[model samples]
Target: MPQPSVLIAGAGPSGLVLALVLLQNGVHVRIIDKERTHRIGSRAAGVMARTLELYAQLGVLNDILAVTSPFGPMASYDFGELVPKSKTAFLFEHQEPTPDIPYPNTEAVNQTKHEGVLREHLAKLGCTVELAAELRGFEQSAEGVMAKIMHTAEDGRQNEETATFEWLVGTDGAHSVVRKQLGLSFLGETRTEHVVGLGDIVVEEGLGMDVAHMWFINGKMILVRPDDVNNKMFSFLYRTSSAEKPLTREDFVEEFYRITGRRDVKFGEATWLSKYTPNIRMVDTMRKGRVFVAGDAAHCHTPTGGQGLNSSVQDAANLGWKLALVYKKLAPASLLDTYAEERMRVIAHMLGLTTALGDTNRANMGKKDFKMQHPDAMRMLGVNYRGSSIVCEEPGAAEGVDDPYMGGVGGRVQAAYRAPDASELVPAGKQDKTTRLFEMFSASRHTVLVFGGDAGTRAPVVKALEHFPATGVIHAVLVLGQGNATPSDAPSFATVLEDRAGHAYKGYDVDTGELAVVVVRPDGVVGVVASDAEGLERYFKKILIAA
Candidate 1:
């Protein structure tokens, strides 16, 4: 019943995710969608490793894993041939799980189911998406944002209501009303020459579910991928000429038969169907005043690397915690500006990457010898905010590194990088069992990790953190060396762990006996890497408001 602090104008995965992050941080939110019902389709189905790690932080990994499957190999067949001519290499190389990267592979799950899981989590947090409620317009002042929302009743009557909130986020797809109203220039190209018909359909038999079936016929490509574990449902993407009119289920069926020349496969009803033309566009900036944009609203590209939905979710994650801190008066409002600063560059790089992949895909449609391979960068674990203004790296740390998609598996541990997970840590009193660094991370606060130092050595760092609120905004974790005992003066609120197997030290690149401190932001990004309390204080000063 408390007035919502944030108004999110889309209920897709991006909006739902932002709402969940804010709710977890105790920030109330109102998420609205213009559609009467959630969309159904296998639109953006590839969930990458980086997204999986983020899902873990939000406590939705188990549910997501339940409904998703690993990316399967693409099996290409010659036209009119039932047998596959060749099995194209896996789009991404299979990497085994390591201590640093737990989720090493991409998973496949439709956008609809993905949104459902996120919505379920939001409901548990006591928030629901306001269906049939459309954000018509909004105006912002220095204090807050006043939004005009149009609500439709069951009988089709409509009423416009004015609502006030501290912040507004537009996650409302590519045709974002928020972006248009804000007058943000969406500068990019739309490739009308390339069009594809996409939909999910049920096939009773004559298709294997383990691999994606691909056929290049008459200078067009038809890619059919298994949609579910039941083996009866599948999703298809059919390349169509610009001359062709908008496609229906009947048209899709007719084309499928004509393109593949397969009569043995029995077709059932199509669950969803639509035409897709790569928009390949992005806003000049993700923010304008108190209102902001994320997901497809900010940038949209071809789904070549399966990065669209994942990048959108990442955009929400980056903005969510920053918004919460500013809303709670824990951090300065200027902190929200960093959202556009960090995400815009990354989205630009993503657009280029997907565009190149799409170009390659179109060019290689009929090339029998071409093999499709996605670069490891598509995993997104390598994505970093290396040059972010808020991140601080101490003297002698790696500097001048230009790679944004660096530092995932086997990469150096430094400031502004994704904080790698460390396992086999023994808690203060529990020698029989152990936990991981990820288990200690919370979406609600910044985690200050004090590594390899005893109580006397770490006392300065702990004392410095005392300047900030300890209840919900900041937490300290002391990771002692293998033989080091728990510090006698350790703060009651601090968690003490022993790096028995050195996994923590190795993952963090900290020497066994060297003392170090890593400040991890609420979004699981390493905010700062330092050797002393002064470094920790300086980083927090940039992030938290002075007490």
Candidate 2:
């Protein structure tokens, strides 16, 4: 009998990522796509720093960054002249290193190219994206999820196969078959007033194709960024009405002229042109019993601020670990609800923001103040789970105090709270900080930041964890800043940094005197915040242990 596990539908960025994660953590996953063969379709160009951190955990970030470099800087254009380059210029990084936000800013590469990199990684994990197999129907039961997948064989044959798994995830694009099959309602609008676009073309030599250049030509906006991997191939984002229906190669040419104000532009060839009528909508619920939805299946919107693909990738990251726990029997399956509950807010927010940005396109606002908590800023990595059922109904939601990204809701103010004592987790007399621990912990899991001194005081926490390791509960980190050499019983060990001068602690915003801890889920969202190890333990029991 096949193992009861996850059934992931739609192999877009989110679905494919969910497959990679589950397989890595020992969960069996079968991913099916509606299309017969994967086509290098549209470009989902923007990748946020937090998403990059998730990719780093998946272990392909370095390779991804290497393949997509040397894209000139990000430039704003006034008329035909270039303004100052953007601070977030690095294709694969926002800022190299920052003590506040562990992740970098955001990165950009065509969706086709990015998807290719993901496919390569997925192949290495003993899973292949089964093309042509479409999820046409599914039945969810307490036992497992059985899906009817339709596919046409290479011999020009047609077949329907029923596959059974413990759970099903829909990652299909905007018009999701799984959503329709489940009778779920996608609540929102398909009101598109202007036409948005994307295409790959060659630019005039030394037009500074090295930098990601944006031109707000009159009211239409043009965003062009060179693919570091291929100089001849550059991705362009703009609005056009050159064609009443779908724009063509000539339309792209004319639009480029309209924006660049230079009809002298010539191109060698065209790779892809995709036109999307912005539909800002999200499913009423991301989860219904054993079936779940993600990515475009759960939420899609106008590509105005470029948050659709970023948010979808984030949804994948959030669900991957939780679903793994379900498969491992570490927690009751109900724990999976957190995926929908937590990610729904993200999707809803994106839809709201994108819709607003779409409305403002006629005015063509420049830059939109990256610092402002404008909905479009969600394009950066600032999602949270403060009001989540998994957040233990913590007291801070009203004032917006405790959730991760405490910097402020909608990413308003960054985590401005810094500790007075920079060396929070170092031994008193010994020059040891938890820098290595932070690096290693950040490498794999979104670490639990323990702040109170001598975490061993809460020995019962370790006992509880050891007692429930089979239950598949929360992963714990023992943070000790000022005092200790060892942990008595609990999983308490202060961060031991390479240099004890407190450089690393300062890097992550941990102060010696602050007696607080943050529960960071695998997807990098802060699940809970507490005063001490006991609070941390309470969070573990609440969110991690048996459903």
Candidate 3:
């Protein structure tokens, strides 16, 4: 077999996602993890809305939703109280699904099963994560990267090998060897004042599985939530000022009974136990030469808002398409620079949001204020890349908008925001069945939407798209306004559709009879919002290589 184009240093969600994206785009990838076996604990459990949308594009959302549970309410209790005081507080409130936003509520699934679903998808694609294969070191030049990989056998045998690939991505986590080799500054502070103990235990009985239980006694706190449907397994977090020594299952059991005053709630067994020290850190940049770092290796913060895994997955999604385009020679290497430019801004904003949530949790130690509801920003639907170096915007466009986390949806549709979904679109000359805009999106290609333009107005825009590769790379869709018939002169290369309910026009913020062009990138971000053919050509010029 030929050498892989990319070597991913971690097999966690971020690495798996990046590998899947590359393979979907017809790029070769080899993903590796240092562990001897797949992980088994409920590390990160919350899956946000934006992540679910991305999974839908990857064709794994159904499997994920099939096994996961919706984010439920939390039952709060005071010191030594067997009965709960309140049961209305929620980590994330459920929102009704709108035409534009399909998965409006957060879902809960442990990291083990979540990774299992992703690996299953990868297996169907003829790729698997190489266990026990660790990236020890790597050196990158202008052309490719030379990596040293350490492989450990099951019986304690170890061997080192050298390999070469076009690019190396580090998703090896916070203590990443790849990041340290690159000498990037991980600038941040470690919170030493508090330490958290996390683990999974089997509860015999007496706790309901529908709600997460939280207990506050004197100045101590412990939160436990059901992990499986059987209500036998649960995940808990105990926060304290200090733990001079490592904690055992006995210690956790003793503390649980002491805090909750519920000795009747017997404990069976402990599945896993670990300590967590809150560290707020991020790298200045994500790339250097042919090497790049993403996910936890790039940034890590408190897991208060369930943004760590979601942000990591988003980072992979943002970089995967650009890397594929560059690898295939369809786009210039400069296109890869925008990956860092776009994601770093979003990561900075996310770190602040999660840190604030952590501070609030710390401040409300003994109070009855544990009824926390995550802000809408946690959904991440409004994160935008307005004013990006590669995005093109028409005059009077909302460029450099300050609302990074809560703009674009139900607001003016801008150039670099998340593209909203539109339904009730009928193919030209057919009204039997309708399709949604999201159904036409794919991770391997770009979607160009021409909204409500006359034949003469659309001819030039359609002609501009001919400059790029047409086979599985760039797809053009012509969306006509309501009550407008498809013109005979419509371009044969484009898919012509009629908006029967005007959802396409309304969701995109385009007026009827308006001549506008919107380019959705492979990652479902609005890359360009243009008024005419000149704007379209100018935008693609920055992305595609010159003929």
Q: In candidate 3, where is summed lDDT lowest over 10 consecutive residues?
A: 393-402
TM-score of model number 2: 0.82
Expressed as tens digits, the lDDT of each residue in 1-547 for candidate 3 is 5679999999999999999999999899999999999988888898988898889888889999987898788888876666789888887888998778889899999888999999999999889999999998988888899999999999989999999999999999999998999999899888877688888999888788889998866777798988896748999998855667776899898888888888878888898888888889999999998999999999989888899999999999999999998998988998899999999988888888889887886677777565554788888888878667888755655544466676663576678888888888998867798988887777898888888768877788877887777667888888888888778666554678888888889988898777988888888888888888888888888888852
RMSD of each: 1.9, 5.0, 1.8
Q: lDDT of each model, Cα atoms only? A: 0.86, 0.63, 0.86
Give one digit per residue, the lDDT tens place, for model 2 in 435-503.
333343432243555544444444544454454454223445555543344444332333322224454
Q: What lDDT does model 3 reach?
A: 0.86
Off by over 4 Å in 2: 1-4, 70-96, 204-206, 229-231, 242-245, 258-261, 364-376, 393-396, 399-438, 442-452, 455-458, 470-475, 482-499, 503-517, 544-547
Compute the lDDT of residue 258 as modeled in candidate 2.
65
Evaluate residue 480 in candidate 3 and report its C-alpha lDDT on the 0 to 100 scale: 85
Q: What is the lDDT of residue 15 in candidate 3?
A: 98
Q: Model 1, poorest ten-residue lDDT window?
A: 393-402
- Candidate 1 per-residue lDDT over residues 471-544, each given as its tens digit: 68887888888878767866543788888888889888897666799988877888988888989988988888
Clashing pairs in 1: none
